[model samples]
Target chain A: MTYTITQISIFAENRPGRLAAIAEALESENINILAFSIAEASGFGVIRALVDDPERAFKKLSSLGYVVSTTEVIGIKMHDRPGGLREISRMLGDAGINIEYAYAYTGRPNAVLIIRVDHVDEAINAILSKGGQLIQRTELA
Target chain B: MKYLDPRIEEMPRTEIEALQFKLLKTLVYRLYSFSDFYRSRMKEHNVHPDDIRSLDDIVKLPFMYKKDLRDNYPDGMFIGGQEDLVRYHVSSGTTGKPTVVGYTHRDLENWAISVARGLTSIGLGRRDVLQVSYGYGLFTGGLGLHYGAERMGATVVPASVGNTERQIELIQDLRVTAIACTPSYMLHLSEVAEKMGVSFERDTRLRTAVLGAEPWSEKMRARIEGSTGIKAYDIYGTSELSGPLFTECSEQNGIHIWGDLAYVEVIDPETGERLGPGEKGELVITMLQKEALPMMRYRIGDITSFEDSVCGCGRSHVRISRIQGRVDDMLIIRGINVFPSQIEHALMSVPELGEHFQIVVDRKGALDTMLVRVELKSAQLFSDKLDDLIRLKNKVAHQLRNNLNVAVDVELVSPETLTRFEGKAKRVIDRRVL
Candidate 1:
């Protein structure tokens, strides 16, 4: 079963050294950033990260006065070769599952793609039908 | 013109001084006879009522500070008994315990008259509909403007703060001709009006604005006038001196203090030496006719200068410039004095920045660090790139350094993030232990 993986998002002022400060705070807490993305708005930036410890990272980041929230995302494991991401994207696209945002990291044998989509259940079914392995939440921990 | 009270408004300077002397003599004698606080204070200085023969001799009397009011607390300095009192108002006391002020029936009447005079000077009349937007109740702004507008025969809306949507609707529905509120709130109103598609120039009959209760600049006056299409005038007074008492006339030069009701003097804050005309210093005032609580030589802690010459409005009363800043609000950064108003003036010059800002002062080891967090205007916020934002931040910091003569850290934030105040806005947050 492709269970939902929780990802943490932090709202921060769009300024120099703000991201470094957040990174320093998470590093101090021993939280490893598995994947991360930065979304820039008009005068602020949102840092969305998939960390090894979502609960710990959320708590540590929030205590430092950063507006933070958690969203459920599905992670997929595909072959590390080219077309790994294309295969998963084609399956989700064929099923009409919209990917709101996505980020990826490649390991030696496999690549993990973190996908935030509108229809989570349909995307999971599409990935399963295409023989794509779903990364479980407990595997990161 | 249309004087609220022609006799006092038309009185000559010499006659006003004589009247002030007579009232000072009576007030000092009464204080010596009744209130132990004033009696001991006067005796400590070895001054008697008879010593005050002329207005110049008023300098010999002791000066009272805001701390004195706090030390006296609930009722130590009030002369009359409980039976003689008609009303009481209090300071906001955001810093500490509230200082109390009482008013007799006559005191209330005179306060109404003082405000009425100011309202009339700015061309408010019976035919005008005035929406009193200052907070009412314990704070003097609401009731002070209320009574004055009523006395001037203007239809009073009594809209005492914080219903923004309804306030705009009232302006449109009732055809409000004038408004009295803090200058910042007026800017907020204008912003809200624009969003709601209510243009004051086309949709409302608002013609006059009497802004006071906080220090504002001529730049702000020009901004308000340009946006709302109303003549923005400054009104000045403190709760201890009877709410808002003086206002700018049609000429819009400076505030015309009523000479017959209150005597004004500017003294060097450090030396207590009276400064000449056009010299800025601490403003000290003596109420000539307050019955319940007559304030004599009260140091109001505001920094301003006096204009000696007669105003173009044909009034001989001494006009004081807009309050620069309070002695208490002055920040000494790296041994240099800086007022928030100066910083505001600098920031307002830049069109990309919004009106809301916060001054955060912290001590980093042995050095004092000032961080100014200002909001970007909505249009600027949308169009600014990362490099442009950094350049804007540095530009603002450069401007602040030039104006304050002290380096400051400027942090540009998103629009509508910094807090907007409906009442007296608290802009400075000092975190230094000292």
Candidate 2:
């Protein structure tokens, strides 16, 4: 399956209105956000977002004075069965690629896996070579 | 480089004294309007605004201490009325109580300008991208640096702090040029960068770093600069006194104080008399041009010194040495003054211990007990050989007693036992109740 791909940009802060400015820029560019997560510390915050038009979103966010960068995260469609993640993790683990963090949500048809791995290029290549279907975030968004 | 008062920022010795005299007059006069505390204190000293005609007359005004701010609480001492205040930033409530400081729009602008000036001093320009890692909200460092970056016409990457994985990715992808954060945080970032096999120094576009808000020794500076492969400059300021109060020029000898906008004085903490050049004492500040939240003869409590010699970098403004310690945080244990920074410096000098450590002060009966809990990165610490651990403990104790003039018990905790602070870690815990 060809994954419905959407770009994810992680936003960080060194000042106020930084995240808001990033979101505003994306909205101004008419980029649709599927999901977002933020973690803050004393003087900064890390913002992660799933958005439509990943490449343009990256360029627009950067132009608007944001530390925007794209990460190739896979939206994997899996059965809502138990050990669905275990199979994926085992496959990746067997391939010697460690999963750093993963986000998941249930869809009407299937469960979505937002997987972040140690080596994005290697994991994506391995999964694709093995005929694994990578779903796009737009379908969910 | 247009200065509101060009003479002070780029002035000869003869002119600075005269400028100090004129500004002191204006400062004293200004205090009468909004600073009720200073106004009353000046009256109690039998002094009026007009009476302060010279730099020597600065003594006529009573000393303003941090306790004064703490005692006043929210808005008691502000010279400008509450209506003028655009925002208020409260100190981290680690001390007895957090002292709230108000900032007018002008004050905020001044903060941005000051930090921008600091950035410029370190060769930052419009073409550079500044990745600020200081946290925003209430704390002045992040917002203050943010405005300065924007003021300089530079692209600001407001990465507030943490989540190093993304931080590294952003650094590489965006090609950020400069970074501003605590030196410890920078070191931590460097450590993580290595583990990720990210050649931060070679690959990333970072050229300069501005580190402050916490006391760091010269040894630490060398380490930071060498490891990060960036020119690390020391920035000095406080929320109450305004952030980025001083900036180090290329010479890196001493930080140049903004003598025109803010009058700085070094005084003996005990005698309250102004000290001569090169003598260490507590730093006091007086806002000359500040309209909102102007402070008159405010004691910053930071121990420092001033040098009048022309800087090697050729900036004529008076230079302030690095802050030694805070008077309020000075722990007088068993009749000796001990600063937590001193212990931290000594501990940090030891390569075996990590950057994180804690000073726990608990009391037993009438006497106070000071215990230093340090963490080592080695998984099997104090194993196989107990002598190394004992030697480490003795070395820490000796340094504490010798440098801080206070005796403290040193304990080597496991790797993850000692507390790790996100910002301005609490170094002391006074268990005394009276």
Candidate 3:
């Protein structure tokens, strides 16, 4: 089985306190936000976050009236050095897999890269064949 | 065209005048003796009831302005008291005092009869189910069409305004054959229907529409009728003559004004001289049979030519051309009359807004959208928080809607964002393409 992580995306108006409301709901449920990024378009923003409990976060945010969706993304553990992104990107590019969007976070020893790709299964096989390490959901906990 | 009452509708031009002369003589005699408002108006113009010898002698009477309605307002212009009145419809007045129209039971009957005849001219009858989509309350459009459709024995759906998706469903589930609404609303409904994957031709059995209350183009008619495969007829009337009084017959050439109910004339707005048939000018009408609020030669500010010739549909009623434009600056938004002064009046009540505001009106997907971009007093008026801005914008928009009775989009801009004194009607930027 492939290692796929669930990322929660929240549709929010690009206004102050919107992010805080979403965060407040997650906090109330004791759901830890592992990694988060804000993608802004027009007068609104899409807030993508990786949480300790995807299902719990989805319910809490929805009940609180925040529009949220869960998407499966590949989190790759990479070298914390300068060529970490280039190496991972070039490996997928050589295999003809297109990365739609990506973001990264750093912890001790290594950086974790979260990427959304069209051909998820094929990209995972290519990266695994190249000896790259994929981050598991439990590893963050 | 079919006739609901063939005796009156299909009568010869001479007989139409005979009916008009009989009603006019009775109306003049009643007003001269009973109504101080009409008696005084006639005396000032040196005309008596005896002066009105024939239909053409209507020129001897003085013209009544919209100001007459305003000056009298609520009850002053009315012929009888509340005991004699059955209903009242109020319209927006330019000078803040709303013009109120009162109707007795007989007056309502005549209005419904007029609508019945109009519906019949357009080929809608008892078997057809009509949806009166015009607003229902104090404004006249909704109730006027409702009564007329009911009188004609058409099962009427009093689906007055808004709830586009639900109205679309009713059109399908109820098998609504005809609808009465503004031309803009028809376009909006069509656009919404398309979004819901509902085709008027396929999903619904809508065959006709009676659209009016605001000026629309023949091109707009072609656009609506051509796309939706529904026959769109132009309905014409102002609140002065009891809301929607007449509509275009099957000929679709001009809106037929029933000769028995009202006498029609086109006059040079400047000189007050009556123009011959086919001459474009202001429309003046005398409501012959109205009892509660009998209006004689009320100057309706709409600009159009008068057609006295017979319509191809075989009706001998006088027809008016499609309203070219208005001599007044009244703006009709989604069938409701909106005045620019009313916009300023709404803005004055809001403390957060500055004096300078620009009104941008545009047609989006066939529906008219009015965007009011007003300047905030200062950035310090509210924080940059999205909630605060939206709340304040909604407040301004809510104030506008409450005042004007039409939904509008409000944009909050920084002070000095609006340009000053560009031209006449600088406060408005109407980008609507006809």
Candidate 4:
């Protein structure tokens, strides 16, 4: 039933060493970045990540003047096969949900598909009804 | 204590009108006889000096626009020879050629007197140290206020624009009491002072500020007053009318237009019909005493109105309300007229947004688009939630649409990204031209 994962989004200008500065600050705070994605447009970039201790990391980054926001993204555990993503995406599409963006990481037996969609509740229902395993926050932590 | 020139400033209403009529007759006669440009303009309207029998007949004369000054250019508007002219100043000319204005010896003396009258009305006197922070050179704001403060025997600072830190240092060191600059610059100075750990309320002897040379709102006046702990007053004049002339009395109701020096009128800008007191319209002025370059029925593009009721300061000179905006600054968007000041007023109402913003206009396909990029005050820092920023943006956009009667795109920019101006800030960027 629980399918949501907390992701930290950091807004920063696309300049030299900006990401390095953010990473250095997080490293100094001993915060681990579980998964991350960078989306850039023009001269601005947003770094979205699933970090351990999202609250502490958010405060530390934001105190440095980075515009930070938290978003609830769905993390679905898929079979470690070729059609795993296609299967989950097809189910969500058939349920009339839009995938804003997505990022993923692979493990030995399975892969985790971190998805940002327009309709979170409907996506969760569609994934569970289609017999896909949902990743819970406790499991990820 | 009451009057700058008791004889003229205290003249009765009946005698004031009579004096304006007599001066208007003489000015018109002189222009008709001396300047070929005025003669041709008057002849085209089939009017002469004899046509002006009274002050009410001022409407009969042909209206002179800014184009008239631009058309004449260099020395064509002067009524006397080169030797008669002692000083000349040019307009900023944001759109086209700069208009030139000349001052005779008598004209300079009259200008000093007019500005001195304004300074005196605002309680500025010999003992106070006055800082003239307005830009000097071709622009008349600096020297105009400088000479006027000197004429009042106040110790003058002459700290022309720029060098905010040094300016603040001088104010603290010299214990400057009065200041003259644009309202935007005063806000910028306050920001710099805050960063320098200098508080105007506790760190300096600043008491009064005379802000002018651009249109600002009463909300801005209050902001300046609250930030600097000074009584902010609005002074009204242009280089064409002799820079930095009229100012608000201690009552701070409206600026007192020197009736003996310049006859003032308000008219419906479109129909050119004169508007009665309290009705908003274009301001028209006639310089009665200028000897070198005199303007008769010159339509200053500023939009304002008159307050006919006598002021609490006991000055009989007519009071002019704060300037709303220039006719040239009006922008037509989606068939609706929008003044940037209207947007500023709307933004000031919202406590979260910062004071700096730029209006960007662009035509997308067939429809025009307006984007107001505003900075968030540091106190309203964007939290780790997109909902807050989105909600604030929607709120500002809704407020702007309600105030401007047109939809606007509100972009919440990072604080301090927008340029801060040391002079009159240029806030509008029209990319439709590109």
Best by lDDT: 3
Interface RMSD of each: 8.8, 17.4, 13.0, 4.6
Clashing pairs in 1: none
* Candidate 1 Cα RMSD after full superposition onto the native fold (Å): 12.0
User: Higher DockQ: candidate 1 or 3?
Assistant: 1
Candidate lDDT scores, in order, read: 0.82, 0.70, 0.85, 0.82
Whose lDDT is higher: candidate 1's or candidate 2's? 1
Lowest lDDT 10-residue stretch of candidate 2 chain A: A4-13
lDDT of 1 at A106: 81
Clashes of each: 0, 23, 0, 0
Index of the highest-TM-score prediction:
3
Instruction: Point out where model 1 deviates above 4 Å.
Output: A1-141, B330-434
Give the residue spans of candidate 4 off by over 4 A: A1-141, B330-434
Q: What is the Å distance of residue B382 in model 2 from its true position? A: 34
Candidate 2 residue-wise lDDT at B30: 71
lDDT of 2 by residue, A15-109 (tens): 56666767788889898776666644323344666776778887775554344456667766676789887776677777787765567766645
Candidate number with the higher DockQ (2 or 3): 3
TM, every model: 0.63, 0.58, 0.72, 0.60
How do the residues B1-434 of candidate 4 rate in per-residue lDDT, one tens digit apiece?
55667787767777888888888899999999999989999999999888888789888899898778867787788898989888988753323346678999888888889888888888888888999998788778899999988887889999998899999999999999989987767877888899999998899999899988755678878788887789999998888888889999899999998888999999999999999999999999999988888898999888999986777887788999998867777664643346777788889888877789999988663246899988766423444344555677799999888777669998876556578999998999976531
Which lDDT tens digits does candidate 2 get at residues B1-434?
33323444567867877887887787777776557787788888898887776788888888777667767776777765778888887653223345678888888777777766667766788888888887777667788788888987789999987687898788889999888887667777787888899876778888788877766668878887788788888888877777655678766788887666677789988889899999999988887766656677788778899998887755577789988877777653432235666677777777666666787776553235688877654422222123344666688678656555446887654344346677878868776441
Per-residue C-alpha lDDT of model 3 across residues B1-113, encoded as one tens digit per residue: 37998888778999889889999999999989988888999999999999889989988989998888878777888887899998989887764567789999999999999
TM-score of chain A of 4: 0.91
